[model samples]
Target: MALVIEGEERISAPVDKVWAALNDPAVLKEAIPGCQKLEMKSPTEMAATVVLKIGPIKATFQGEVTLKNLNPPNGYTIEGEGKGGIAGFAKGGADVTLAADGDNATILKYAAKADVGGKIAQLGSRLIESTSKKLAGQFFSTFGEKVGG
Candidate 1:
């Protein structure tokens, strides 16, 4: 199945700072829900291990994350693909954009698309979509706090 999610957040921090936090693995690891490991392989590439639960299904995903279409302190596209063994696989990408709300605040926006298959997809779309939205909310809320304060 395929899923699409989009949202915007107002971060109480400068755009430059938000941009820096977005590219930092340490920050991402903390913000990402259930992220066990996140390590940079190159300037635009990372290796990750994350545990996720959707409805009655839970899985550990090992994946490669790549950053593309870099535009400096503006935004970029983040793409990732992971294998979860019997749970199945997931591949997705998000187009993120950052705009200055003010000298000390930024508006972060993202539109994401994802596809899942195998056992996880068997859970149905509603459960998967809600779970995905919750995860995304958690990440940004944590990230905003970390970056803003």
Candidate 2:
């Protein structure tokens, strides 16, 4: 199934700082919910391992993330795909944009689309969507704190 999600966050940090944080693996690893490992393979690519629980299922996913459309301190598109052995596979992409709220703050907006296949897909869209939404929220909340601090 396919899912789409969108939201905006007001971050208490400069747009440039927020953009730097977004590209930092150390910062991303802390912000990402259930992220066990996140390593940059190149300037635009990263490898990751994440553990997640969805309803009655739990799985560890190995994934790769790519950043596209360079627009320093402004925005870009992030795409990723993950495999979870027998549990399934997931793939998604999000377009993220950042605007300055002030010299010391920024507004971040994102629109995401995702898909799942295999056992996880059988669980239904509601569950998957909710879980994805929750994870995304957690990431931004933590990210805001980390960068804003």
Candidate 3:
């Protein structure tokens, strides 16, 4: 399956603060809902395990995530690939942009694209779209709360 999703999140923090939050592995571990483990493998790389449940299916995905195309306090892109055992695999990337609203506010915009193969693709587009949106919302909501505090 080939899927695309776009979303924006307004954060109650400065661009620099938000950028710091984005780069910090600890912050990401806290913000990513359903994430079981997140380990920093290098400055720009991480290994993670996430358990995702959509409707009647539940799977654990082990993946490597990389951050690149960095422009401090502005934008960056992240790419990841996950293996889900018999469920097949998934690969995706997201471009995240941050714009300062004032001294203590920022707008975060993200455009994401993903592809799933094998059994995962058989799940149908509607299910995939809904699950993606829910996951995105969960991530941003948790991120905003963490950043706001």
Candidate 4:
């Protein structure tokens, strides 16, 4: 099944600082919910291992993430596909935009699309949808709290 999610958050930092933190592997590892390992391969590619729990099921996902559409302190598109062995696969992408909320704050917005298959999808749309939203929320909240934002 496919899911669409959108939200915005204001960070107490400049747009450039927020953008740099977004691209930094260490910051991303700390900000991303359930992220266990993250390695940057190039300026725009990363390898990640994340562990997630949904309802009564738990799974570890190995994924490769890629960043596209460079716009400097503005926005970019991020995509990733992960394999969870017998639990199945999940793939998604998001278009993220950033704007200045003020001279010292930035507003970050995202329009994300995701899909899951196999056992993960069998958990029902409602469960998956809620979990996805929760994960996204956790990431952004952690991000906002870090990097002085």
Collision count for each candidate, in order: 0, 0, 0, 1
Which portions of model 1 show Cα errors greater than 4 Å?
Answer: none
Query: Model 2 residue 96 lDDT?
Result: 93
RMSD of each: 0.6, 0.7, 1.0, 0.8
Residue 14 accuracy (lDDT) in model 4: 93
TM-scores, each model vs. reference = 0.98, 0.98, 0.96, 0.98
lDDT of 4 at 138: 84
Across 1-149, the per-residue lDDT of candidate 4 in tens digits comes to 99999998889999999999989999999998889999999999999999998887799999999999989989999999999888889999999999998799999999999999989999999999999999988888789889654
Q: Is candidate 1 or candidate 3 better by TM-score?
A: 1
Give the Cα lDDT of each candidate.
0.95, 0.93, 0.87, 0.92
Best by lDDT: 1
- By descending lDDT, how would the candidates be arranged? 1, 2, 4, 3
> Residue by residue across 1-149, what tens digits does model 2's lDDT show?
89998998899999989999999999999998999999999999999999988888899999999999979989999999999999999999999999999689999999999999989999998999999999888888898999998
What does the lDDT read for residue 32 in candidate 1? 91
- Stretches > 4 Å off in candidate 2: none
- Candidate 4 all-Cα RMSD: 0.8
Lowest summed lDDT window (length 10), candidate 1: 50-59
Off by over 4 Å in 3: none
- State which candidate, 3 or 4, has the greater TM-score: 4
